[model samples]
Target chain A: MSCFILEQAGIDAPETLADVLAAAETIRDAGIMQHPVAMVSGAGWNLAQEFVNLYLGHGGSFFEPGSAAPAINNDAGLATLEALKALTSFSNPDYLTFDSNSIQALWEAGEVALMLHWGSRGAGILSGDNAAPEIVEATVLAAAPTVEGQSRPATTLWWDGFTIAANTSDADAEASFLAMLNGITPERVAANSELAVWLGEGYQPTPASAGVIASAEGGAAPYPMTPYMGLMHTALGDNLAGFLQGTASAEETLETIEAAYVTAARAQGFLN
Target chain B: MKHRTFFWFILPSLIAMILFIALPVGSVFVQSLHVEHEQVLRTVENCGPFGCTEETVIDRAATEELRAAQPLGRFAGLSNYTDRNHLAFSELGVMWERSDSFADFTRRAMTLPFWRAMAFTLTFTFVVTPLVLLLGLAIALGVNALPRAFRGPTIFVSLLPMIVTPLIGSLILFWMVDSRGVLGAALQTLMNDPNLSLKASPTLTWIMLMVYGVWSSAPFAFIVFYAGLQTVPEEPLEAAMIDGASRWQRIRYVVIPHLMPLAVFITLMQLMDNFRVFEPIVGFQAQANATSLSYNIFNYLRGDAAQFGAAATTSMLTILGVVVLLTPVLMRTWRDFNRKGH
Candidate 1:
């Protein structure tokens, strides 16, 4: 969806590595420098790095922040790299680290050119009468792009859901639990959207709740919750923090992160 | 008759001890051991139900495979200990390798959180104790000297924080220190700087925490010292004043010594309380700069995998650190108690 919009706005949307490089050359040739890109802090960092490497590999430049990134190759950093790979390969390359609070500030200030953020953050940007319209204008979800001939855009769903613990003693609770799960009706979902607005702007319900949420106001894609989510988050956060701080090169960061994920998987009994 | 009386006297306490203290401690110890061997025990138990049954005979190979896959063992030996190798070392090798030696684990465990907590505890004790002591003493002296009509109101004012719940006090502090809070706004207004947010900078955070700590704690000290001041012999203060001593001299020479015992008591109590500073820090911002040792231990214990053995080790180390730091002051108090013999 983002690619479609960008393409309509005359921005060439690249799907593959080779195409991305060609797009980079075209942009550079047109004397239009890529502006600052926002990345979610922590696990999002690794994804950002992968994205950066893909871009840089195709002849793009990265904007280094004030602090020197740390030197990586630590076990933790390697784990982060691995976690990033396991999650998604379309890591946003040119990204800046921002927590929810920092992102809110950046969005309000219109400081960031692009942001790859949770759908809920949009509600926050829209909330409070004082919120700047420019933030709403600038914000766009990072949807997966289709290659030149592809018809549909791929959207990742980030979902937070409830599950019964294996050790839950009350077997009878399942009926009530299923009822409660089903109770998130369209009305309830719309109410939740309002509640999210009250809580903070940029808050959006999961995509599954979108049909219900769309009735109230702002809503977007809900990222899926994968088993490797936590590991990916931690790895990305640590590595990206390291990269932004200038401690690790993009390649070293990615490689080290990949190794770390392998180790973590093994430790968790997921790998042989 | 005396034996019967002694038995009656001891039995209640004995039962209470077994039911409350002893039972809980024993359970915790067992739980600690289980935590130590968690993985192996899980693996073994995953095999099948404990103690084979007739049903197991029907599918021996399947059950055996299931059991192997599950892992079942009452005792996992050092498997649990090995997973916690990170707690021992500042930097472990990048590979997923367990520590080769228990000695390394023991050494690392002793230093990281244990020593760091100790240092924080010591700083907390030192900073809060003397400040509370002096402030409390001053409030006590002032209250004691107040006219009889105003005395009650003043004492009540000093006792307000003590009467209010600590949790509530912490909440109040949280609001006050919050960037969008009233206190933050007041500070910003007074400083005439819009950008000066309390929670943003480390220095401001420390100041806010310290102020909150003193505000919530000074009252207790004030109440104790005020009571102590009431008991101070008036004759010495009168004598000092008659001897051409100024108010400062009279306080320095006469009042402080008279209040020494009470001061020592308050100091010891405050030292212990401040060393275990937990709730306030926890209630403060999630990533606030006010992390004390107790909070760190609590956070570590509350992680996804509750590392009880690690928690126990950390707890023991914290106790040791406190004892080491407080021994000298405790000894002085002991001597003072013996001398007073009350």
Candidate 2:
């Protein structure tokens, strides 16, 4: 699961996207931190994933019902892009080069006060040798802020599970399933609860797991599982940077993404 | 040599080329003409730790039945090449018809992935090839002029860029050119602009990629020319010296002519290598700013749902690009060979 990880030393935790943006000026004016937010707009699929979180927060869906036609070139899409551009105004100038690894580095170095990252990174941030002591002590995990009138946090839900291969024998599949079941038993889950935000019985919530739990309880939607969503993701990842760079408008960028997705969908037989 | 004897001598290599090179390319061409069958979709409850939600999933049994019946997938013909992700012929026509000016047309065209990658690839190939040749020749000459005792260390030091792996070299440079990194900080101070980020701008990223291309590849041309320098006989030099030629004149006259063939060889190799530029873009994570045909193919094949048809089409297009780029050099070499024979 992913949610907002904020450094609380400089300011109270932001509860809404407006609060986050509003806090940026106060933090900068008071000489607390120049950039309060760290977002990825440049490399990898994380940017697209983040975009989906923001778009869904604005009540947007990826496709028309029962079809592969893209429905993102709408008001929600434009609002999401505009919000992202506003957030970037308070982020580092080198935000275009930001990816998972680099943003994590910035967080650990205490350069950025807020970031949206995976909960699995909690262990490293809490006890990693590279992280500054003050930053570690001040770090707080919370559900990502939502847009106005939205109760759910601006984030998506994800889960990790085990599955047996189709080619495995019946006996082997049974053994594999038994092993996985044993691994996630209540007793074992209680013992290793701090390692992750576990959903197994007897697992207790820790500060590190707070964000994921809160987000799940707040009705964060799961990422879309449509077959053609992968193509949409690739198109979004490839094209969104142009808008963030100020070279393309939100409409133009969304149009490019739709065109790209349609072409890829046609090639993959998801569209004619 | 007898024709039959020559044919028998090259028989092993000919078979190896056919098996390794020709067959794979032929299969890629065939794959480019087909696409996956239309998927059968079904809504199912996907239970997980975070409760069950109705999700759209591929109906595996139905899809598998379709695949089993027609294993090669639905035939797509040349539609993959004409799609917006590849050549984008129809999109280009739209851009031409709708745009108000030539610059507007070009700007709209660059928004297409195929044209965007092509712009970077062609620019990288054309810019880096000549720079590599010039820098390599300069280094070769400077090293050749060094004292015999210092030459060994100098040559070794100069070859370090090529000796280091390209990916690692680019990654190190990527770090150094970060906004807060040593080189990046120094560049910012020098330019008197706090916001001068090398990775943020497309033009800067293109320049950095080409700079890396030249830095890593110059050593290859240098070593080739250095070896050729050793073979430049003393007879012409002595004659030129006796005829009152200056040092620059001697080099311009005799040394350059002797190195002409080696320059041609280096140019041929460099053009092919630069046209397929891939590693540095990935290492630097510059895909947002610059992507080559090879990078496009890599992108198509990556992630959960690999577009095999798109990847194959890009592969064929890349092969075609390399052939077109090399044709002039190949024809010139052939003409030179014929002239010498005559």
Candidate 3:
């Protein structure tokens, strides 16, 4: 759930994550907010991880192509996990088990005050009767991602794309299909009710895409891509969960991640 | 002449087994000997005033050429079997030398991912198989004692677990046990702890998974045991009751001996089935707590790049485990057949 606020808070935008947290805490203290904040985990934790990476000024990227080993135990990794704990301090207790859908549901049910989630899921909140009724038309998105030391909000850029089968019978037809998808007119966007696609190249952000769009405008770095990225995701998600559950200390958790990656890399024939 | 005719009649089944079972197994064994290919990359180092910098590049064309020559990459010659993820003998060796006691060594070794999966697999099979048999037998005996009119509905209701697909069944159980769901809420209130989650502890998660396994498979056992109960001759019950035997004695002496064959059948089939448990791990989101050999194979085949070699090795090992589990049962059946013929 990304923060949605009416202009009545006497603020143009939340300048940092702290601003949103402080405001939520104050409102919660005044007995105003029901659900303080809902943090998403499981696959949806990628968004939170990337946001924390930005906030912590992580000096290294795990997904860089050809990087031989993971730097998951580094200072940036530890700092990001610490920051993640703070961000989710007031979240739903079941956040460990929450996928993107459940977190989105929390926000939709009006149980959550704010959350950082995909704009697609968050868009319904700005509609009728789902959440804080007063902010139906008053919602404002933050313009940038916030970095720990940096003034701007840094985010990793991401989007889903499509491809055609190389063995298609008609190359001409496939090429035309690609062209039609790319060259959709505003009329087409309206007719199809396409929210995620480029609307005649002006790049308007839907409620679902707002967090990501803001990150892009703020010059968020591209998401990391490495040979063992799938393994890394599994390693990070599984081990980081242990730390969250307090089953293992942060150091032991990081060590577990490092060992897992090494073993996986060896299995994949990346190492001797 | 009868035997020869029977051979001709079974020729198609033999051919089917060769093609479907033997061929796939043979291929897996071969694949295990060949490692999954990695993109062959060549590195370049540029010397400069600022200390030489190195870069690695995937030589796609060269890789394709190399692949074209030996398609499955290099012949691993059992090296894949010995690799850290598979045999893990080397890691075990390292842990063994460092640890003081056998218990300490096992604890360290179980931390290895492969060994961890093995522990879950063995635990699930041994635990669930008996559970299915016991629960099944209990339900069968209870239902059998009921009036004839009620037996039909009870049997139908009992078989419901096997009716749904395993994955769907597991998902339903998972949702019901979710910390926010009804059962989870009930457990929390019962324990008087507001935040008790079944998934919080590794031991609790494993126990929950095993319980789900038994609950899901108990019906199969119940049905089999129910069918076995029908064949218990009325004469034997009359004889046992006339001998002044109690109801429990009648079951222990007469009913159980008659049900031994069906029990053996269930044991053999269930051992093989339970040994390959996979779905509940995904449903329970217990990949962090438990993993079976089948799940271990799936892990290798799951990503952007499938490590088919590791999957193949795990598959072969899984087949070996199933074979080992079956051997005693097969020998017992053979011995019983010989005694009957004599």
DockQ of predictions, in order shown: 0.08, 0.72, 0.25
Clashing pairs in 2: none
Residues B149-210, model 2: lDDT tens digits? 99999999999999999999999999999998999999999999977889888899999999
B272-299 per-residue lDDT for model 1 (tens digits): 7887777666555422234566765675
Q: Docking category for candidate 1?
A: incorrect
Return the TM-score for each candidate structure: 0.58, 0.97, 0.85
DockQ for model 3? Answer: 0.25
Worst 10 contiguous positions by lDDT, candidate 3 chain B: B46-55
Error of 1 at B139 (Å): 1.5
lDDT tens per residue, model 3, B22-78:
999999899988864555666776442223445555666876787898876668798
In TM-score terms, candidate 2 sits at: 0.97
Report the poorest 10 consecutive residues by lDDT, candidate 3 chain A: A1-10
Which parts of model 2 have CA positions greater than 4 angstroms off? A1-11
What lDDT does model 3 reach? 0.70
Residue B86 miss distance in model 2 (angstroms):
1.0
The better candidate by DockQ, 1 or 3, is 3
- For chain B alone, what TM-score does every candidate structure achieve against the true structure? 0.71, 0.98, 0.93
**Candidate 1: Cα lDDT at A198:** 25
List residue ranges in candidate 1 displaced over 4 A. A1-118, A121-157, A160-272, B1-115, B179-197, B286-290, B339-342
